[model samples]
Target: MIRNPSWVLRSYPSGMPTVGNWMLEDRPIPEATKGELLAKTLWLSVDPYMRGRISQAKNYATGFGVGDLMSGGGVGEVIKSESPDFKPGDIVVSDYFGWQPFTTIPASSAKLVAATDAPVEASLSFLGMPGLTAYFALLKTGDPKEGETVLISAASGGVGQIAGQIARIKGLDPVAVAGTDAKLEWCKQLGYRECVNHRTSADLVADVAAACPNGVDLFIDNTAGPIHDAAMLNLNTFGRVVVVGTVALADRFDQPDIGLRHLRKTLIARARIEGFLLDDHESEFETAKADLLSWFKQGLFETREDVIEGIEAVPYAFVRMMNGENFGKQLVKL
Candidate 1:
């Protein structure tokens, strides 16, 4: 029997979360039944969105039941299986189970490996929900046109990075806004036409106005708050703003107040601000997967995973991500 270590939600978070809200515990694995696979986790995906899951409020899904195995998404190797569809050695990705060393799941929940040395984590990163989120949000909602200026907040992150690339692919001038100089530099290397450090900009309205002489045509908001307020002020007439995340104020289900100033500007400029859900585009996942895979093959994209080595580190990693300590995709390893 394998000992499965998992991080559980002990209490709901208030404002920024701390390690106290979670606790690590150990459990045992059972033998796989027919049509099931006994999988050993190798990597765990820790994302910022998980903060909402632990809270006692409504989000894309119902809030995770208190004390239920804290689950999101994971990639694992099948060590033993009773299903003919899966062999002893196979990798599967799913939102199946939590921070555990082992989990037994039906073969259907498992997605088979189509590529070798697939880094598996990409199933949870670029090839998974985040990638889909970025793909559809840009093409369907943000809709940047050729030669138009695209400004993305949280530009160095998993979703933001992918969105920036998609903007470039669509022939838009993509400018990324990040928290640090290093992240801004990385954005530039990733082909952003312009990059700015959110930490350094004292007057983001003036800075963005200076950077985009013609004004921003599309704004992809991940870090919403002051950046949002400032960006709306600098938006070109008919600018489209896509609200993907509101990480700037943490995971409060109640929407943040943007004040009348920015609200008035949005209306005056004839701007359209829309919210998006990635799962709504799940029907087009295969299409998104094919295009994203093509980009990967062409060496057009790369991802950073802040993967902690063990289940013991899951709490710390999560707290770190909530406080904006991680630079890219934040995940924990089994």
Candidate 2:
């Protein structure tokens, strides 16, 4: 019998999740049923969205219950199959079952990843949810125009990095704010018009304002605390703000967020602020994948995946990502 190791939620975290909150278990791998196929995980993704899942508070999606298997996006190889649609050795991606070495899922639920000229890992990162989030949010929500100033927070992260690059491709002036000098420099190399080290900048708002002399026309906010406030202050008339991920509020989502109220600024500038989720834009996934892959193939876009070996590192990777220690997309390679 195959020894299948998995990570399960031990308890709901009040704030940032600790390694203690997760428990590892080993169980015999179950066989695929009549309509199900067994998949062995090859790669597991740790993302900011998972932070919200471990909390007790009810989100748009149900929170992980105590002792429940932690689930996220995972790329796996089908080992045993009872369904004709899937054969052994087929690579697939699923969002329903993860944090486990092996999973038995319905054949219809798992998506078969086609053999691409590019790295298959790209199917899980830039050509995956993060890229889709960047595409639809920037195009449909932000509605950026040529020569418009686009400001992206958490600019070196999985989603923000792509958003800024997409903005540049659309002929917009992309300015980014990241925590470290290395991240800022990376963003600059990614073709950002300007990149600011928000952590080192003496005056973050002033820095952002100086970067965008004409003011921010499109703002994709990933960390929505001080960065969001700074973006709000510099928003021009009819500006658009797409609220993607709120890393700044990662630990404090349970409590009331007290900060500079941007209600007056929104009213004055007639700016629009809207929250975005990839699940809401499922229909646009193909379009997004096509554009991202085309750019990637043409050498017009690029991204880095910070991969660590072993499933044992999943919890630590999640925690580190929450602290903004990850320079790119955080992944666990089994």
Per-residue lDDT value at 8 in model 1: 74
TM-score of 1: 0.91
RMSD of 2: 1.3
Among all candidates shown, the one with the greatest lDDT: 2
Candidate 1, superposed: residue stretches over 4 Å from native: 30-37, 80-87, 105-108, 116-118, 251-261
Model 1 Cα lDDT, one tens digit per residue, 1-334: 5567777788787778788888777866757888888888777777767777777666777776668767667788888978778887888887765677787777777787567434678888888888888898888888767899989988878798888887877788999888888888888887898877778998888888887888999999987788887788889999989988888877453455554466778778999999887867778989998898888878878677777787788778877876777888787877
- Please give the CA lDDT of all the candidate structures: 0.80, 0.86
> Best candidate, TM-score-wise?
2
Candidate 2: lDDT of 233? 94
Cα lDDT of model 2 by residue, 129-236, tens digit: 788888888888888888999999888888888988898888989999999989889999998989888888888889999999999998998988888888999999
